[model samples]
Target chain A: MHNASTASTTEAATVPETTSSVDSYFADHPTPPFLDNYKDRIQDLLDFHASSPRPIVLITSGGTTVPLETQTVRFIDNFSAGTRGATSAEHFIAQGYVVIFLHRRFSLLPYSRHYSHSTHCFLDFMRPSEDGKNIQVVDEYRPEMLQVLTRYREAQSKRRLLLLDFVTVSEYLHCLRASALLLAPLGPRVMYYLAAAVSDFFIPTKEMAQHKIQSGDGSLSLTMTQVPKFLSILVHSWATSSYIVSFKLETDPKMLLPKAQQALARYGHQVVVANLLHTRKERVVLISPVASTEYTSNPQYSSHTIDLAPGTEEIEEPLVEELVHRHEDWQSTSSS
Target chain B: MHNASTASTTEAATVPETTSSVDSYFADHPTPPFLDNYKDRIQDLLDFHASSPRPIVLITSGGTTVPLETQTVRFIDNFSAGTRGATSAEHFIAQGYVVIFLHRRFSLLPYSRHYSHSTHCFLDFMRPSEDGKNIQVVDEYRPEMLQVLTRYREAQSKRRLLLLDFVTVSEYLHCLRASALLLAPLGPRVMYYLAAAVSDFFIPTKEMAQHKIQSGDGSLSLTMTQVPKFLSILVHSWATSSYIVSFKLETDPKMLLPKAQQALARYGHQVVVANLLHTRKERVVLISPVASTEYTSNPQYSSHTIDLAPGTEEIEEPLVEELVHRHEDWQSTSSS
Candidate 1:
C-alpha cells in the first residue's frame, strides 16, 4: 500500500507554497447567498440553550465539491458517505447534547440514515391494508420502524437539532467561519466536531468558465489553487475556548498515528480521531495531548484505539461516550 | 442566453480534430468486470420476449462520472436528476412495453422515485399505530402510496422490468454496446431511449494516478481526452434495425430545434427530443426524420412540441404516448 504521510511530506518540500491565508481566501471568495437566512435560525437555536447546561455541538458532515465552472456541468468530488458524522450526531443526541448538523445537501442525516439510502426501497417495507385503502408496515419490519419513528418524533418535538446544508467548498468554508464565531460565546460548553471531508484544492470563482466547459478541444487541462487550512484560525481566533475535534483519514495503516499526532501538535486542537479508509467503520484511534506531570511545563501525548464491541453494529456509540467524558473533564478543569 | 449550438460549432473549427473511432475506443478500454453476470440476465429477458408481440425498450438514464484516479478519491461528474428517464420508464411500462432500465446507481428509479430523494425523508410518511406496536402511513399519504405500490407490485410480478446500473463513462459505453447487440435479433420490435447525460471528456485508466491525487503541490492541473461519440455507431452498427430515440439538452432557446434537427441529420437516427435546461420538465420538442412523399429522394424533418397540460403534473406521460405511436407506425410500415 502507498504510504500517505511519506507522499505528502515529500511533495511539500519541492512545491512552491501557494496556500492562501484564511483572511485572503475569505476576501477573494464571496459568501454563499443563503448564509443570511441561516443566521437567524442559528441565533435562535443558540439562544434556546444559552442558559442551560447542555453542551452544544456543531457537526459538519459529507464531502465538499470543487466546481470547475461557474455554471458547473462538471466538478471534482471527494468520496464520502457521511456515515461518521451522521452516526456520531445520533449518539450525541441520545446522550442529551444539542446538535447543529451542517452537512452536504443530500448526504445522510441521523435518524433517517437507517432507511433513506438503504438497499431496499422504503416502500418495500410497506404493504396495503386488507381493504387496499391504507398502507401499513410489513410485520417483519414494524418494530424497527416504530423505534426509529419514536426517536425522530421526539427529536422533532424537542427541537434539539438544527439542520443546515452546503454543496461547494466555498460555501463550506464560509459557513464554518460564521458558525465558529457564533458558537464562541459558549466557551468550554461547545464542541466543534469537524468530520467533513473538505477538498484540498479548488478553482477560484474569477478563473472559472461562465458556461459549461467545452470538450471540442483535443485535451482539456484544469489548474486548481490549493485550499487554505483553517484549523489554526479556528483554534486561535474563532472558537478559542471551545473543545475541538478533527479527523484524519489515510489509506496507509502505518501513517495513521503519526499524522494524527502531527495535527494535534500543529493545530493545538483537543482531539484528532484517525482511521484508515478501509477499516474506518470497525476501529479508530483518538490522539490527544495531556499534561506529563503536575510540575512539568511540557505536555505528553495519549492515543487510545476504540474497536466495535462484540455485539454492537457501530463504533460511534463508544466513540461518542469517550468524547463526552473528555469534554466533561475539560469543562470542570477550565471552569475551576 | 448563450447559444449552445454556436459555441460547440465555433469551437470545433478552431480545435484540432481528436475524436476517436468506436472500434479503437472499445479496444482501448476494458469492459466492466460484472458484464458476464449481466449478459445472462440480458439473454433471459430477450428470450422471454422473443415469441411475444410485446415491445422491449432499453432506457438509459442518469449521469456518468470521469475518475481522476484509479482508487477514485476524486472524480468529475455530470449533473442529472435522472427524472426524465425514470418518469418515462413508468409511462412505458403502463403502455405495455417491457423495460430494461439502464441507470446510474442510486439515481431515481420508477415507482420508488416518488418517495426517495424527496424534500421530506421517507420516514416522514410513517407513524406508529394507536397501540404503538405497528407502523402505518399517514392518512393523507396512504392513497398515493397505495397507487404506487400497486403498479410496482404488478411490474414485479410480470417480470417486465430489468434494472442495470453503471457509474463511469467507460462502464456505460461497454454496457450500451453489450445491450444493443444482445437486443439486435429483436429487429424493429425494440426501442433504444438514450437519455443519459454522458460525460464528454475522461482520463484514460492507464494515465490516471494509482492512488488519491496529492494536493500538497501549489497548483494541480489535469488533462483529459475527449470521449468518442457513440450515437452513430449505435444507429448503424450495434442495432441497425432497432427504433432509436435520443435526447438533446441545451440552455439556449434558439438552439433547441436547430441543434436537434442537426443531430438527426448527422447521426441518421429516428428522433431527437430537445429541451431547454430550465424548462425541461415543462416542455420539449420532438424532432424526427419523415418521408416527405411517396417518391421523395430524401427524408424531411418534422418537429412537434409537447407542453405540460393545465391539470397534469408530468410531461413524460404525453411524451411517451407520442413515441409509442411513432414506434407502432414504424413497426407496421417496416414489416409490410
Candidate 2:
C-alpha cells in the first residue's frame, strides 16, 4: 500500500529552493523505533475509515524534544502541555469526526485532559468508601467524572479515536509523513490540525554527542541548524486534497499576524491560527486565504470576534466549531 | 526568625576564589513568587521537627529548566524523571525521617510515583462497576493501590512529608537557599540530599530575549553562561552542620569517578553519589571522604558492591539504608 506513495515522494524529492527536501531530512536522521508499528496503525485506520465514512482529523499535540546527545541526558524542549490538541480532539469527536491523536508521550489526552492536568493529584479526586474497603471518585466530582467516562467509553467502543504518540522531533516528523500519506486517499474529507509546538532548531543526529555532554566547561556554546520547513511538502504532496490548518504561536503581538500570513502564503494551506503566548487560551486569530477573523472568550469582542462566555466553555470549543464549519465548506467546494 | 541568618549570609558573601557565592547569585537574579511562602513552609517544618525530634531530610528532586527567552516559548531541559529522588524520599520516610520533598513542578512524588509514572494510563487502572454506576480500581491493582494509599494517608495525617516545587533554575536555587537557611537551626540533625539535575548553563536575565526568538534567521547560535557553582556556598555557610550528599551523573565512564572525587574534595560534602546515565537505575557509586564503594541491583557485583536481589526492592533501598548508617556515625563522631 505504501509502495506507490513512497515512489512518488522519492521522485518528488527535488532540492527545495531554500532548504533541504523532506526526503533528504528523513535520510539524514534515523527513524524512530515506533516507526515499525506505523504501517499496522495506518492500515487499521484505513480499514476503519472504509467501513465508516466520517471525516477524519489528525491532531498533533504537545511539544517535541530535540535531544542534545544520542543517549539523551539533555534536550531542548518547546513549551507546550498538549492542552489545545487534546481539547480540540474531544470537540472533533463530538462533531462526529474520527480523531487520530498524535501527541507527546506523558502529555494530556482527549478524555483524560480534564483530570490529568488538574492542579489536584489524581488521588485527591478519589475517596475511601464508608466501609474503607474500596475507593471511588469524590462525591462532588462524581457526576463530571461519569460524564467524561461515558463519552470516553462510547468513543472507544465505536473506535472513533486512535491514540498515537511521539517524543523527539525526528519521531514526530516521520510519523507525520507516514500518517499523511496513509490518509491521502480520504481526500478533502480529512483535516490536518497541526497544533504541536515542534522544535525550530535541532542538533543533527551525526553531530550529537554519543553520551551526556561533559559539564566541566565554564560556558556551553551550541550551534543548531534550522529544521527544514516541511509544511510546504505536507501541503503540496503528502496530503494535497486534505484541509490543512497550521498554528502560529508567538510572544510578540507584532510578529503573530505577519508570521501567520507568511506561513499561509508560503505553504498555501487553508488556514493559519495565530496566537500570542500569554493570551493563547483566551484569544486566537484565524487567518484564511480570503479573510482573517478573531475569536475571544471576552464578551466585549462579540461584534468583531466569536465571543464565548468566560467560564461556560473553553476558547477551543468555539474555535473548533468555526474550524468544522470551514472544513465542511471546503469539502463541498472540492467535491463540486 | 530569618533576620539573623540573612545578616550572617550577607556578611559571609565574600567573592569566592573559584565561583560566585549563593548570596551574590540571588542578588543578581530576581526572586521567584514563592519566596514569600518559603518562610512559612520552613517554620512549619521546624515546628514539626521540634515536636517529633526525628532526623529531617530535604530531598531535592527532578531536573531544573533553563529558559531560552524571558517569556519562554523554548527551554533547555535536563533529562530526568526524578525517579531517584522520589524513590529515595519514600525510603527515607519509611526509615522514620521527616522528608521535605523539593521537586520540579509536575515531577513524580514519593508515594504517588508508582501509579503516576507508570506506562499504563490512569484510567486503565480503573474499571466501571458491573452495574455501570461507579468506577473503581481494577481488581488486579487493588492490593498495590491500597498499600500505597494507606502509606500516603499516614504520611499526610502525621505531617511527616512536605511537598514543595519549582520549575526554573532560578526558582530552584532561591528555594534551595531559603530552605537550607531555615533548616540550619537544626544543625547536625538535618541532611541535604541534592539529587536534582541542575542546568550547568543558563541565559542571564538581562541578556535573555524578551519575546519568542525569530526563527527566520535560518540558524541559531546560543551562548549560555555557566550557572555559578553554589555548592561551595552551600557547604561553607548554608546548613553547614548538615550532612550533604550530592549527585554526579555522567555519560562517560572515565569522567564519572574523577568528577565525583573532585566534587567531594572541592565542596567537602559528606558523600557524592556517582552514576552513569544508562546504568543509573541498576548501579551507582557512593564516594565518601574515607572510601568509595559501588551499589548495584545486579547480584554479580555482590562481592565488592552492595547488591540486592533484583525486584526485591529499588537500588535506593540499600543506598538509603547505608547512608542512614553513615549519617548516624557522623552524628555520634561530631557530638563526641
Q: Which ten residues in a row have the lowest lDDT in candidate 2 chain A?
A: A294-303
Evaluated with lDDT, which candidate comes out highest?
1
Interface RMSD of 2: 1.4
lDDT of 2 at A93: 95
CAPRI-wise, candidate 2 is medium
TM-score of chain B of 2: 0.89
Over the stretch A231-308, how does candidate 1's per-residue lDDT look in tens digits?
766765677788889999877676678778767665667889998888899999998766432112344678899999
**Native-vs-model 2 lDDT?**
0.79
**lDDT, model 1, position B59:** 98
The pairs that clash in candidate 2 are none
**Candidate 2, position B8, lDDT:** 26
> What is the per-residue lDDT of model 1 for residues B169-241, given as tens digits with 9 covering 90 to 100?
9899999999988998887889999999999888876789976676667789888888876776676567778
- At residue B292, candidate 2 shows an lDDT of 25
